[model samples]
Structure formats: C-alpha cells, structure tokens
Target chain A: AQSVSQHNHHVILSEAASLELGCNYSYGGTVNLFWYVQYPGQHLQLLLKYFSGDPLVKGIKGFEAEFIKSKFSFNLRKPSVQWSDTAEYFCAVNRRTGFQKLVFGTGTRLLVSP
Target chain B: GAGVSQSPRYKVAKRGQDVALRCDPISGHVSLFWYQQALGQGPEFLTYFQNEAQLDKSGLPSDRFFAERPEGSVSTLKIQRTQQEDSAVYLCASSLDGGVSQPQHFGDGTRLSIL
Candidate 1:
C-alpha cells in the first residue's frame, strides 16, 4: 500500500520567515505529487502539482515544491512567508497505475505570526 | 455554477440514524470524487466516479458507506446506521477531465455531526 508521510505536525514562524515542509512517500513506481492548502473554514485548494518533467514546480501564491526522486520526497517551500499563509497544508501522492487513487499524508499546520 | 456545491452545509444526526449528503459538481465536469475529512486530518478518498460509472470504490471503509452518481452529474453519499466515528466533513470535488494532469475543484463540504 502507498502512504504519504509529512514530518512536521505543527510549525510556527514569524512573518517573512522561510518555510519548508517535508513530505515523503513510499512508492517505487511512477507517481504524481500534489500540495493542497485548506484555509480556516474554507475548502481544500490546490497549491501545486508535479506530474512529469521538471523537478521544480511553481504554484500559486508564491509557493513552490521540489520533487526529489532519489530521496522519494516532494518538499514544499516558500522563500518568505506572510501571515496570510497560515493554514493547514497536505501532501498527496497518486500512483501512475492501479486506479490512480490519491493517498494523502497527515497535514501540517502552519501558523505565521506577524 | 462557478464551483462545486454541497448541500446541508451542516448536518447533525443521531447515532444509528441514516443520512444522505448531496454534491453538485460543476457543469461539464467529467469526473467526480468524494472524500471524508476528519478534524485535524487530511481528506481521505471515499470513492470516484467517471460519468455514470463508479470506477473506484476501494476507499470506502465498509458496506454501510454507499455513494452513487446515477446520472454522472449529481452525486450522493449515503451512510446507513451512522456511528459516532462517521462524524466528519464530506467533501466533493470535480475535474474537467479524469486525466492525471487536471486539477480537482473542491466544494466547501457538508459537516456531518453524529451526536
């Protein structure tokens, strides 16, 4: 069975601080990676996705992620964070075959204090 | 509609009762999916439907959990003999195509509470 693991459970940072959320998955085959964000009382929204091609993928709201095949990791990063970026972030993985079902990791709660 | 819509923004059901949650996907969406989100956790896939056919239902926890997209447009998730553990937000999402590259649009979801 495929599973996603998010190393950080909660992260607290001041405004303008650098952000990095670690995500690793347990799958040997081709996979699709995604990062989704859920604001307070809002629905889940896609932040970025990596299907094929470049390992570095840029997403909305100045967010980006790097897919490292060697490490089996797709880590979410932001050069500088804002207070508005406070939300729960989830990392998901979908296998290339076998139904393409998305397996989600336990979310990471980010609190950006101004 | 601009985005996916779910009905009964909030639902409170007694234990052992039955509840039906509705999801209205965006117009012309070819794929629909249902997910269950517990508090402080990521959304878990429940099922997926392509058009009127249910392509995948392996995520459903048990036989008590049922979902249908009769016309391939509107979908419903029905829980029979609901338990306290069944209390969670039910989310619906739709995509333009069922392909791997297309992103999914999610609804605000129906928060179900079993009291």
Candidate 2:
C-alpha cells in the first residue's frame, strides 16, 4: 500500500536551533507534496507545497522543504526555530492525477524550548 | 464563513449508537474531503466529494460508515453501530477544485468518542 513516513516521532530543540524533519513517501508515480503544521488547539494549516518546479520551495514563517525525487523524500527544514514554532508537523502527498486526496505521514511533534 | 466549518466540536456516544458529523465547506469550494485522525497519528482520508458527486469512498473502513454531499454545499458523515475503534477526530476540508495543486483548508474538526 502507498504510505508516507516520518522517521522522527518527537523532536526537542532550543531556540535558534536548526531543524530538519524527514519525510519519505512510497509511491512510484508523479505526485504533489505538502507540509502542514498544527498548533495547539488549532486546525492544520498549509506550510508549503511542491507540485512541479524548483526542487526547493519556501513557505511562510521561514519554512522550506526540498523534494528529492530520486530518494522519494521531501524533508522540511528551518534554519532557526523559535519557541513559538512548537507544534505538530505532517508531510502529505497525492497523485498528480485522479482524486486529489492526500496521504499523510504519522506527524512529527516538535518542541522548541526557550 | 471564511473557512471550512464542522459541527459539534466534540461528541460522546455509547458503542452501537449512530452518530452524524456535519461539515460545511466554503461557499465556492468545489471539492470536499473527510478524514479520521487517531490520537498521536496524522489524519487518514475517509471520503471525497466533488460538488454533489461522491467521487470516492474507498477510504471508508466499513459498510457502517456513510457520507453524503446531497446538494453539493453541506456534507455529513454517518456511522451506524459505532464501535470503540471508531473513536477519533473527524476532520473536514475543502479546496477550490479537485485540481492536483489546490491547497485544502481544514476545519477544527469534531472529536468523536465512542464509549
């Protein structure tokens, strides 16, 4: 079955720490990738998405993700994380055709301590 | 409303009871989706609707689960004879179209607890 995987279940970091949350998908066809963030008591929000273009895409709040097709990976990254960045992050993908339903990975919980 | 909206932010029901969860997508959104999110896990797709048509129900786990988008604007998910394993947060999302690239807007979700 097709699935998305996030190797890190939980991560802790101090303020200003660089961050990288790994995401890998098991699909062989063309796909669109996305990163979503959910703060405490909030709904999921789109951080960024990669359809087709430059492999690296930047999103709001200084977040970015690189889509490495050869590796079937689209890892999220941030140069410096703030305490306010603590939240759950999910990586998702969908086929480039047919129903556009997303298949999401088990999310990574990030705690950025001050 | 400006975003996708789901009703009954929380619901508690005994096992075997029937429950209905409602969702109101953005006025102009052409695509709607339903997902079930278990604790400590990401949301899993349950169903999809394009306007008034039910394009896909493949993600539904059992025959007891039913979803409808009768008029194309509002949608509902009905679970008959719910089981303890049915307890999860039900999320609703909508996008401008069924396009491969449209970003979906999600609601806060309705947390369902089956006792």
RMSD of each: 1.1, 0.8
Judging by TM-score against the true structure, name the best candidate. Answer: 2
lDDT of model 1, residue B95: 90
Candidate 1 structure lDDT: 0.93
lDDT of 1 at B71: 93
Output the lDDT of residue A42, model 2: 95
For model 1, how does the per-residue alpha-carbon lDDT over A7-43 read when each residue is reduced to its tens digit? 9999999999999999999987899999999998889
Ten-residue stretch with the least lDDT total in model 1 chain A: A94-103
**lDDT string, candidate 2, B1-115, tens digits:** 4788999999999999999999999899999999999998999999999999999999999999999999999999999999999999999999999888899999999999999
Which residue pairs collide in model 1, if any? none
True contact recovery of candidate 1? 0.60
Strongest candidate by lDDT: 2
